[model samples]
Target: MNVLLVSRGSTHHGGHDAIHRLAAAATETTGVPVRACFLDGAEPSLHAALDAVPEHCEVLLVATHLPPDRYLDTWIRRAVAHWRSTRGRRARILVAAPLATQPALVTAVGDAITGEHTTLDGNPGPFRSPAWSQITRHRRHVLVCRGPRCTAYGADHVAATLGNRLKEHGLGDDVLVTATGCLFPCNLGPLVVVYPDDTWYEHVDAGLAVRITDEHLRDSMPVDGRRPRDSPPL
Candidate 1:
């Protein structure tokens, strides 16, 4: 059986590299070819990774995360179910317990925290990428749900299309796009919630996402018939 390590990916380049390193270590330790998949904020998301798996291979899925995020656990199960049902494949997907639940983690943490080890006192600089030209100038935040349903339904494509459209229209500075966890309405995904206006759009696709960027993101005129009814602001 092949192994797949799923992680909560980071936007920072170094953070992403660390996840890759973790996957490599797992592969070395297990003597099995391992693949990496991200939860959010990176390419080759869990759905994409699953798609890359051969139709006949059984997979042992390892969540390489600590603290056991409930959202990730739920989404992982859902993604596996969706993959099996949609593909109608015989691949056996078995989920391993999260790394945090391993007894060795406690000892490892204890060993790492030696008596001589202590944090240095210093002021950390701005926690943002320099490539974000208008990081401090964002007028609105666009939250895209990257839940199981949303990801399976093409939320990644929606995010990419929305971002590109915003940049093409020179609205990137005004709007900041964020990949979020489940928005509570998984069935209505891929979903997007814009704030501080709190305008929520459900069942969004690349075309509808771009339309939102053009109408609501650009001029604050929310597209008609997309917003959820009676839903509170997010």
Candidate 2:
């Protein structure tokens, strides 16, 4: 049996690396092929990962949320069932019990403690943060999509280029850049959306990111967003 660890993916490669280490550890102990796949924001999405598994071998899926996601437990089961129904594949896919319900959860927490720990104090909620209450005075808001498709296409470079170029062009103070999860129309990613006027750009790379910093954010002209493609069918 092959082990597939499912995780809530991240835009940063470091996040994926941590999961990879976990998968490697599992493979070492279980004496089986163990791999990692993301739910979103990283490559080899759940569907793509599922398709890669050979039909001859069964897959044992394990979820990797430490505190456990509020909805992931229910969502993954339904999503997997939907995939199995739609794909009609033969190999068995069994989901391990949700991480939240595992008896080892409490034991794992207890084992981690070496130094003294403080009791829970839930006062001063997230909304109480001073930064959260304040709005940015920046002139433009730029959103860079870090969804799985975009990341696969090099959204990380695009994002970094935007930031560096904006600072170089002296637009950093005037422009706000945010790396966001899944700005849709994911087919035309690495995607960038600039607001106050909602100018959308698709298939952006480092080159286009620099262009956006110079032409759109700096000059206030929405850069050319289309590629050399003919009109779509009506």
Candidate 3:
């Protein structure tokens, strides 16, 4: 067995520690060659780590935290495709928690490979297609930009306020609020994006945040006037 561990930093802690722990355990249990990939924006590409996997080794991808949706999906698909095309049919794919919880990951891997999606037992229905869609539809997404300029202005307060308000509204589970490093437009100090419509807001404050919850989040109204011209593609 050839195990490949990949992890990124999370809101709570960096994923490197968890990846190392898993690699150690796998090496002990299966005596397999374990390769680890720890990304902190200051490390090498994951491909470098994948390239280190020994020949004819079954690949296990473990993620300690949820990764950016777009990038993770693309990588997993590419990996599976490469394995299928070059490594024969003996290659097996396994993912650990957090990434395992992501519907997109499960769907992409399941669609690309053969075999049931199981944790330790039967298939995890929660990770199945329909269930995954429902979970995603209801999962709240909050993106806060804490770019250098934004941090200088007050992006930290914006993130804290949003998180506090979400908890107060009893919508914490339905909301995923995060303060990201940058969203470009460094001049715009504080910025936020609320999905599934990807509504962008600039110069956000507490009062505006409340309105966001009530009008846009609660009532589903479109955010007015603050959308960015270079907003991420839908």
lDDT of 3: 0.60
Q: Could you tell me which residue pairs clash in candidate 1?
A: none
Which sections of candidate 1 miss by over 4 Å? 9-14, 40-42, 113-119, 125-140, 194-199, 215-224, 228-234
lDDT of each: 0.80, 0.77, 0.60
Better of 1 and 2 by lDDT: 1
lDDT string, candidate 2, 1-234, tens digits? 888888876537898988889889988998999998876555555666777898868988888786777455665675577567767887788888777788887787787775477888887556566788788799999989976557656676788788888888888679988878886677798899888767789899888888898988999877886432332754
Any runs in candidate 3 off by more than 4 Å, and if so which?
Answer: 1-139, 229-234
Off by over 4 Å in 2: 1-63, 67-106, 110-115, 119-133, 226-234
lDDT per residue (tens digit) for residues 1-234 in model 1: 888888765447687777778778878998898888876656667778878888788898888777788877887887788877887877888999888989899888888886468777786876776687644679999998876578787788898899889899988778888888778888788889898887888888888987899888898788863445575687
Q: How displaced is residue 63 in candidate 3, in Å?
A: 30
The numbered model that scores best in lDDT is 1
Candidate 3 versus the native: TM-score?
A: 0.40
Residues 1-234 of candidate 3 have per-residue lDDT tens digits of 566665542334354555667778878888877766533221222444555565556677665454445555445555456545644555456665555566787887778688666569875565456555564445658787754345444555566667677777787677677667667865555677887676788788777777777677666785673555566666
Cα deviation of 33 in candidate 1 (Å)?
A: 1.9
Candidate ranking under TM-score, highest first, comes to: 1, 2, 3
| lDDT accuracy of residue 53 in candidate 2 | 90
